[model samples]
Target: MSYIRGYDPDTLREIVDLRECQERLDEIGPQRSLPALLERVWLLKVLGRLDEALVISEQSVRVARMAGTRKDLLRARILHATVLQARGALPAAMQELTTCAEEAEGAEWSGIAAFALQHRGKVSYDAGDYDEARTDFKRALFLRQDAGAADEQLESTLLAIDAADRRRSRTSVAS
Candidate 1:
């Protein structure tokens, strides 16, 4: 079972219940396994605990490097980049995500590549580069569709594309 439970209705944002997250963390209980660390990092990141998330995310990357597969390492790196993005380190986050996306695509890991592209689109959105964000989101949507991703996943990418379009329009109107 994944740690994430649902999405926020108002924004279609991910919603990690605090109580459930804490319980999951406690259940993990000092385990240094990559999955455990990744879950902790995600829970912490969602809880607005970026400092703790960053530490664990880095650790997860290290463990993935030492013990997991290339895919695992890429996943870990992608999560780490998200923590960086959440913490407002856009440049660093973008760099990491860009590398991860390219590497995953090269390996023909369409699902993983789409995941990276989605997050990279998010980073671009955060940086107010709506054109780039929309481009990435479109590519992500294509990849997800090609990989037969779940409906919810496709919805999320579609929503992101819509959001970028809205933002871009708003910006142009203001100019």
Candidate 2:
């Protein structure tokens, strides 16, 4: 499943439509068909509808748990945490990510672990905890590098770190 992590609302809706078509053809099982829900959640998130996205993501997580697929569950948990973070529920988001990170570690899913850690870093950053954010982002960067993720993603993370540092510097100067 080549699930695109970030897509615009229109593209995400198109993906959801395609998945729905497959589901109608009975090609994907009910328990296994989580991509559509996830796509919808992503669409809502892109639209800045955090409440709707959170509800859908929570449902997706339940479905993923019932499907008993580690990859699906990981994606659901990540999306759910993202929704929580967007809603400013940083503590809850961190808790969810921490659980996901532990699960990834147990399953030796380095990619998923890295993804979870990246979000954990984002939550810390949002909560004004730059030290923890930097630590988490560094760990995520290392894991993603070890997992051989695309250079584009690594570059994006580096840019994010640079932006964060610049913002911190400006804040310090202002204070």
Candidate 3:
């Protein structure tokens, strides 16, 4: 189990200096385990290398599945869904995130559960399911709040909830 604490969603976005992170990743070449692969997958996604991200994402999921651990598999699936969303594969993204959310919740990985729910909320909103989107966003906000997670993540989820609510209202009014 490689150190995954430093590569949360915020940290992954902060790894915008890809050249530096890529170099660091190379230094850990021989030890490229599932955690490491997931890290690289996130960084590659941030760097807009969708194709490479997809490869690493799939590899990480495969490695995690072989590990036979719900925790590892849920995290991998979350990252995979993120990359799929980036690539505009919305249906696949939604599926992966939905499963990841459920598994993470059952595995008691609060952070992953909240993250998956947040993304799934976005996916639902994109799919025009405003009610479901609002439900997911509200649930994610509650989870993050209860978990004492970063306020930014909770705030983002809140904003999504508000947007979904407003959209639903507008749709109803239009009808």
Please name the candidate that would achieve the greatest TM-score relative to the true structure. Answer: 1
Model 3 poorest 10 in a row by lDDT: 4-13
Clashing pairs in 1: none
Each candidate structure's TM-score, on Cα atoms with residue i matched to residue i, is 0.93, 0.77, 0.74
* Model 2 agreement with the true structure over 56-136: per-residue lDDT tens digits: 898999999898498889989998998898888889999999999889978988889988987887888778766677677
True-structure RMSD, every candidate: 1.8, 6.0, 5.2
Evaluated at residue 162, the lDDT of candidate 2 is: 59
Give the alpha carbon lDDT tens digit for every residue of 1-175 in model 3: 2222232322122224667666766765745588678888877777788998898889899999997487788888888998988888989999889888887889777888998998888778777888998899888988898788976676677668778888889899998
Q: For residues 44-128, could you state the per-residue lDDT of candidate 1 as single tens digits?
A: 8888889999999999999999999999999999999999999999999999999999999999999999999999999998889
**Runs in model 3 lying further than 4 Å from the true structure:** 1-31, 169-175
Better of 2 and 3 by TM-score: 2
TM-score of 1: 0.93
Question: Model 2 reaches what TM-score against the true structure?
Answer: 0.77
